[model samples]
Target: MRENTEVVVVGGGYAGVMAADRLTQRDDVTVTLINPRPAFVHRVRLHQMVAGTHTAVVGYQEVLAEGVRLVTDTVTRIDAGGRAVELASGGAVRYDYLVYAVGSGSADPQVPGAAEFAYPIAGLEEAQRLLPVLAAASASAPVTVVGAGPTGIETAAELAEQGRRVTLVCGGVLGPYLHRRGRRSVAGRLAALRVTVLEGAEAKVTAVTRDAVRLADGRELPSAVTIWTAGFGVPDLARRSGLSTDALGRLLTDETLTSVDDDRVVAAGDSAAPSGLPLRMSCQMAMPLGARAADTVLSRLAGERPEPLNQSFGAQCLSLGRGSGVFQFGNRSDVAVWFHVAGRLGAKMKETVCKGIVKHLADEAQKPGGYSLHRMKGGAGRREALEAVRAEAPAIERIS
Candidate 1:
């Protein structure tokens, strides 16, 4: 292995940050992380921020590991032959190893009038812009949610709690991801909050004016505010460069997270769809996937074949309201495990999950070589005790 290896990771989300941080631990590799924004948007907290529950605009420099170079720019092109990343600012970045962690976003944008009128709860910028719009609008204003997925349900419940007349228009089965009882439980919660759940409503939102949603059903709902949270499509860079991509533009990867076209390039987070086991785009997947990507890269550098990714996680955590939530335990394949939780306990658990994410990033910085879990300083710079181990201990295996 050369000491001057240059690794450029594209994407500032969880996967990119974790890969860059882990790589920087080794003195030999020069890591450059490129993204469009300087701040790592904590998407899980967007809904809370929109509801005025929390406010901590996390900056990249704060979470990024020391000695790692960060470049803020959108990647426009990828020249694999030359190993050069063409940036939007008419510049180029070369890489010995490339980690494609650019995640997914709102899948379809061509929905008629949806972009112009509907608000999305994806990231900080959108949520910040949406807060004032909701606060100033009438408390009794009719709010129509376009999906009944996890995000749509959470948003609808939150809005309903805020005393807005919420009507959730689900095109198909409502809460199909949840168990039958779990689904009905959530429906009951929505009803308690005065949220009208409309299932099997084929709502082709033809036009979304400032006042209402013009549906193809000829039933014009007086939706003073429309929230569209459905259909997330991965970034198009994989297919744009002619790399083998799925129908949704997700780069087809092997079980080891290696791109099908090029073994040297690894894809993670939402942009990756390993052929055998496809993982969804959520905090649950992104967190572990980032660590797995790090493990694969580091193992390859250490002359060891990384284990195939068999990480199975489908526990969908959804925040219902300020102090209410539903914890649906699902098997690896997204089948519910027959246990659930609601109310304050569920909310506390969700809060702990958010805090743990931040803690993991902080823990990564204090560990040497980012190879294994060693004794590291906790939050507030508190020293942690370490256990003595052999020099040839396995610290970087099965990153979990």
Candidate 2:
């Protein structure tokens, strides 16, 4: 290894920040975090920000490690051969190792007039833009939230709590990840809040206008404000840089989180596809992935073997406005079970989850590799995922 090993982490979200902070554990290593924004965005609270209930931002000082340097700029391209990254700020950063954590954003609406008329709540800028529009509009104007994912559900509930006429156009079953009972709890809350929940394929949105949204069933609803939280897509920097990526443009990595193309490159968060089975795009997965990514690099540097990913979800937290929620429990494999916590207790759990996310990051920032969580042991599911990946391509062996 060189006298001073330089590690560059691209992106300042949950994954990047955690990875960068943890990399600071080593005395001989230097960590530089490159991001477009100066502040850390608490993405889970973005819905509340749109509803004018939260700020959705935290200072890097509160979360970033003391030794880690922050660069407020975007990475335009990755020069894998040269082991350097080209930045939008008109310079290149050379690194011995790179952590690709540039996260996901709002996917293209792809519907007629939807792109032009519909407001999205995926990122900070989009939320900021929608805030002014919502403020200027009439209090009783009809508001439509497209997509029934966690983001859409929270946004619809928040607006309805604020006394807006909210309509949720679910493209399919509401909360596809939730159990039937949990789904019922959410539906009950929405009903209590007077927010209309339209489910099934017929409720899928077809297009949007300045004044309304058209459904797949040829029905149109008056929507003075249409908020699209349909789905997320990762930044294409990985694909554009000639790295091996999944169908969705996520960088392909082994179970250890090291890039298949180069051992010196790693991936985490929404932009990583490990063993052909990418984790769900949630904060619940990002922090663990980030820690694993750091471990891979540290192990390689120390000439030690790195452990494969042993990941599993425990529960899904859904906030209904600021007063109600559902803590839908899941098994080791992340499939929802019959049990759940509803109402204020659930809301408190959801709040704890949100606060815990930031606290976990800050803890890792201070103590580096001090974070730990109980993960499921490898089983048939992991074997099947690896078998599928090997069936298509050669297995990527760990370098060290």
Candidate 3:
């Protein structure tokens, strides 16, 4: 690469922002960040925004740190072999280190009319667009949310609590991660809110019109707003660039979050699929991935051995409605157990976590370079392993 210490970060979400902020600590490094939107969207608040309890559109102009360049353009192509990035506006960016965190996009199912009719709540823009649809419908109008994952559950709970008719169509179990108690609590909360949940029924949303949802079972459910919060699929950047990836299109990375076949490139956030474990697509993994990526990058620059990838989240906090949720405690793997929290207290914690996430970005932007060189507090044992990392060395391929 032309620039010895230049860094290019793709996307501006939690993972991208964290990477940018951490890179600023490297006094000798310059970071160039690219994303489609000018502002960073708080993805966690999307459900609240759709519930009509919050009207503000969250952003991150104030969250980015100084010395970090923010480019408001989409990345069209990544030439990994040449260490370059092509933007939609017709220009290319060259870099010595690249942190790919383009993140996952809304997964549209292959059902007949789902693509044409349903609105997903995965991004800020999507939630904003669904507001008008919810507002125009009456209180008793049926609002179906397809998918019973965290996003689906949260969206359904938030709206149902507002006295709107809400239905959650989950093809599988209510929550595959929840323990018996947590599952029961969630079910109770939904029932108390008068929400109808459909489980085990194949929800093939054949069509989405303004007034109804046609299913593959030859049933048409009356719906004013059909919100789909099903699954996540990463952007096609990694696979298109001829990189190693899983079947889900997620870039396959080694233990230390580096691209399996290219040490020059590191993957983070939902877009990164690490070997040995199933990583959940959430801010929980994204934050640590960013910090670890920064450490790996600085370790190479510092001429130290690099660390392998390792992360664990022993808990899951899900907001049931405004000021209410369930905090399912678990081990490193997300097998939620009996110990949990409920009601307003749990909701407050969720809110605090989201706010803290935003404030963290702002802090990183304000203090770049001054601390980017420092390694994270943990992982001291891996210092020697990081020493072998050369700036341009190829990665050891490991697929999930």
Per lDDT, the best of the predicted structures is 2
Model 2: residues with Cα > 4 Å off, grouped in runs: 374-380, 388-394, 397-399
Ordering by lDDT: 2, 3, 1
TM-score for candidate 3, residues paired by index: 0.88
lDDT of 2 by residue, 111-152 (tens): 999899999888999999999999988989999999999999
lDDT at position 375, candidate 3? 41
lDDT of 3: 0.78
- TM-scores for all candidates: the values are 0.87, 0.97, 0.88
Collision count for each candidate, in order? 1, 0, 25
Q: State how far residue 294 of model 1 sits from its true place (Å).
A: 2.0
Candidate 1 runs further than 4 Å off:
201-207, 368-400
- Shift in Å, residue 106, candidate 3: 1.1
Per-residue lDDT for 119-188 in model 3, tens only? 9878878887888888888998889998888899999999998898998887678966788888888898
Error of 1 at 153 (Å): 1.4
Q: Write the per-residue lDDT of candidate 1 for residues 339-398, one digit (tens) a residue.
A: 887777877777787787776766665563443321111121111101121133422212
- Structure candidate 2, residue pairs in collision: none
Give the deviation of candidate 1 from the true structure as CA RMSD.
8.6
- Model 2 score (lDDT): 0.91
* lDDT (CA) per prediction: 0.74, 0.91, 0.78
